[model samples]
Target: MPDEIYLPMYPGEDGLTATIRVNGHDFTGLTLELEVRARGSKNPVVLSTETGELSLDLPDGIIVHYGAELIEALPDGRQTTIDLFSVSGTARKKIGAGYITIGHAGHMLTASLSIVEVPGIQGPRGWAPLFAAVAYGDSVVMRVADWTGGGGDKPSVGQYLGPDGLVDDIAEATDFRGGVGLTPDISVLSTATLDAGQDADVVLDPDSTPEEPKLRFSIPRGEVGRTPDISILPTTTLAPGQPADVVLGPGSTPEEPKLAFFLPAGAQGLPGAPGEPLLLVVSDTVDTGLGGWWVTRDYHAAATCQYLRAEMLVGAATGVTLAVRKNGATVRSGIALGAGVTTITDLGLVLAKGDQVSLHREGGGTLAGPWVMMVQIDGRAP
Candidate 1:
């Protein structure tokens, strides 16, 4: 019951077909209002009430975040809403022709807003610049109604079998075919569904059986981060010396932006000895190739791959240090706070496989504003 659920199997329920004899069809005469809402969205598209059903054909690239509803008008003119995912039987089918449906108390709702997959997008120019994002990260989040079934508000991301018939966290799946029966709680049947994750590489096999494959998957959103790998996690340690590098802006544009990180409080000071010299910088591109010199100040990589490192001061005032070996011996020496922005290669070390990373400051230490200043750490992919 987390905000997301995994559906390795289909239609959470077994032996349940598209139609169910719910409450003796009393809902057939009742007026139903259908609505769909994307997660984190303020808008909801109300489909229909007079017909007790609705079909939608929205343009591609729009992600249906979370939640869909079915409302019915009461005799007193009041309305009650039911989750579309949990609707059962014909009551569910009435929402969309080929989406998954569920019924509760004779009420049915469907989820079949087709996903528009933008295939074969490549080359230097694209909606996004990264080739990894263009080729590998592309995938679909499908919520469809099968001619007989398909039902779920949101697809269960990070859930599916690999081509090797094993549970893979990296394999891409393009389809979660079939119509599912919904439960009142908005959960999907696991038997016939696939939730594709980032790095999802897939090709739907042609169905040899009569059912054929029925799916609606579109590439709504791409993973903003890259898969953390061996190169990202170096084996050598990164030692911190002093002057935790942490400055966000210059390009910390307010709109169309995102940021997260911690910084020192005052201009100078610390808890145990002095805090680590941590640097976090954002750039339009990452240092290309191995041993690529990193921007010393802002340690986090932005605008490219999702690779980043944090530094801390080890021994207080020992070396102009950033990250200290709190428990681990890994350290990043120091920053050369020059007249302007300094790209100190020696200061910014590559992250080692066993190396530990974190802010140098101990518990109650100098706040960034209290000591230095607030630094920005944009979470951009390498």
Candidate 2:
């Protein structure tokens, strides 16, 4: 029943890490339990004891609400809740303003955190990019800020986090509490620091698509950071566990953005733009196996083909094996592969299938796709 402090953090950002100094083996024969919670639901909680590598993979669609509270039964049999409960980012708050800016970092960009007024949470709302449109070594930086920041500061506050939307700046909020002819109390939760170089700068793959954008980030198979917000829209919504990626080009390309996810058949509902097919990489960072890594296939390599497929995939230590399927039936197969001299793995597929293309490979055991994430039909349809 004592007081506790909750520290909120966002993904792709830093999380809370504290060192616990245990005196000599004085406490050897005791059992300790650590409980983690999500979304106010006390029903099922994640636990860890004697930590070496602590990890919690929450359900795909659910936002992570976590706290580590140590429970100890005193010698007298009374249970106590330790104040070790501190919450940080694995996800974002429900509502508020967020921002990201372009042309920062000497045109070298940087990103920062902005927590404005949110409906349910304490500070204001926040925002993150669905995927990293801007890569590291590029002038464009990304961030989460209030929508009301000065126009000049907007770009400074924005970032390409492979996140979904921007947070609204409350500085522009219209407060009704003020009497007639009063200015709104509107305030932004931004640090206005516009972090650069350290922790904020993003790195892009040299061989990514030039046409569309993929927000790339590192998903700690067991690591975590504080980038706690996302944009929700009627047309599109970005969520945790949904991979996001980015491509940094010395110059921009003409690629269009894409979206993909596990749906319950009719769940995709109807495409916002029916006639046009969509190809999207998950906003969540892929956990390539042990030593292996993944990067976007270099367009130059595929440019020689009649049509090219500049695809993205997260590789595992062993190398990814891919299989192409058509209309629910297996057709062609290829190794979507791990990082190497290969620019980007070419599905070498001809579109014509429209949006019927599908890709898949969940890295735990063996690799399997239905690996065709996107099947681009030849623009010159017969």
| Best of the candidates, TM-score | 2
Alpha carbon deviation, residue 285, candidate 1 (Å):
3.7
| Candidate achieving the largest lDDT | 2
For model 1, the stretches where C-alpha displacement exceeds 4 angstroms are 1-269, 275-277, 286-382
Compose the digit string of candidate 2's lDDT tens values, residues 1-382. 1112222333322332322222111222222223322224455333333342223322111122223331111111222222122223343222111221223123221112222222223433343223233323323334344345232333444432322444344333222232457443332222322333334323344444444323334322323443322221122334422433323223322232232333111112121222222233333323435323222221111111122132333222244454444334433444344433222223334334232444444234443321323222221111
The TM-score measured for candidate 1 stands at: 0.15
TM-score of each: 0.15, 0.19
Tell me the whole-model lDDT of each prediction, alpha carbons only.
0.29, 0.29
Model 2: runs farther than 4 Å from truth? 1-278, 286-318, 340-355, 362-382
* lDDT of residue 269 for candidate 2: 14
In the range 221-335, model 1's lDDT, one tens digit per residue, is 4335532111111112223232433333333433322222333322222122223334333222111232223233333221211123333211112112233231244343343
The alpha-carbon deviation from the true structure for residue 255 of candidate 1, after best TM-score superposition, in angstroms, is 19
